[model samples]
Target: MQNDLMGLDSVLSQISDVRQSVTDMNAISIAPNPLSNGAVGQVSFTDIISNAIRNVDSQGQEASQKMTAVDTGQSDDLVGAMIASQKASLSFTAMVQVRNSVMMAYDDVMKMPV
Candidate 1:
């Protein structure tokens, strides 16, 4: 009986929105800056990784806050809180899986004769 507005259309729209934003952000960075620094073409892997970690942490915190609000009688949107928490959990899981894959690739490369 909870409001699961995560219908197919809503989910598809969200995916499209995310894809558009990612493309837009990537385009901004890839564009040649008129007042370019020497590091114009350089994208720092560490920076990207750290930023992703921060984003995941923020999402987790937001989900926690939402759940807290729901539990403490501050907010009554239980479905929303559950959705947020699930989103945070899924993102974290995806990040972990990516990390594992990267580590496996690194290990395989290290074991190569080259």
Candidate 2:
């Protein structure tokens, strides 16, 4: 029972971390960009989405490399590999959710009379 509680605590901690990460991402993406001429510019939506995709891809690649290292006996860090895999999976899932939300919003906008 104690082990189960510990595991649940760990899961909750990870969820909290993920939520914080998402909040940070939103804050960074929406934060004003300062130009060389001292003008504040808005970050483009495309740039934000592109950066997110790149980050997700990089995490996935890192996870794959970790798994491969473990598989080929190049490394003995099974726990680390598993953690990376989970992080990559979570990142991908979050990106998918964001994409779905954007699509739904677009559909709703299209359906509305302009």
Candidate 3:
């Protein structure tokens, strides 16, 4: 089981690397995202943050539903439930880390001699 998980992790890492490469190769624009509400230029910070918050919320909600199913004997897939739980935990942790970084940056900027 451990070996399988390790193999899965490696595959995921490789996939992410490939995705990054593809993104880099395709990133040819000084203009805002044309796909984003037909905007003429780059996506705004607010849009990025709102999307991230929505993603976190969706992950938590999904994990909660899976947990409820397992608890009520509605689902027999223990592994799936565990995976969902872990994903939710990781997402929340990442969200917290980002929040902390943002707060620290804000503090540093405020402390700058103006």
Candidate 4:
């Protein structure tokens, strides 16, 4: 029972790490610059979205590699691989939720009067 609890704790820790990454991605903001024409920060919306997609993709690839390694008897950390797979799944789900919200907002705006 103790080992099971420890495993659960480790999985929870991994989940929090994924959540932190998502939070950090959302925390991107435009910083004020004194030398520029009044344009926003260098980071654009497209760049942020693209970077987030790349990050999620990398995590998924890493999880797949871990699973393959475990299956081939190259790695003994099955629990770690499962945790990584769950983390990747959660991140992908979060990204999908964000995309859905964005689409809903866009639809709402399109329905508004000019």
Predicted structure with the largest lDDT when compared to the true one: 4
Among all windows of 10 consecutive residues in model 3, the one with the lowest summed lDDT is 25-34
| lDDT score of residue 6 within candidate 3 | 100
Candidate 1: clashing pairs of residues: none
lDDT of 2 by residue, 1-114 (tens): 999999999999999999988877732334344645555556777888999999999999999999999999999999999999999999999999999999999999999997
Candidate 3, residues 13-71, lDDT tens digits: the string is 99999998887863334555557765555556777889999998998899889989999
Q: Give lDDT per model, in order.
A: 0.87, 0.91, 0.86, 0.92
Ranking by lDDT: 4, 2, 1, 3
Off by over 4 Å in 1: 1-41
In Å, residue 15's CA in model 3 sits off its true spot by 46
By summed lDDT, the worst window of 10 consecutive residues in model 4 runs over: 26-35
Deviation in Å, model 4, residue 22 alpha carbon:
31
Candidate 4: pairs in clash? none
lDDT of each residue in 1-114, candidate 4, tens digit only: 999999999999999999988877844558667678766665678988999999999999999999999999999999999999999999999999999999999999999999
Residue 98 of candidate 2: its Cα lDDT? 97
For model 1, the local distance difference test gives 0.87
The alpha-carbon lDDT assigned to residue 88 of candidate 2 equals 100
Which is better, 1 or 4, measured by TM-score? 4
List the candidates' TM-scores in order.
0.65, 0.66, 0.64, 0.65
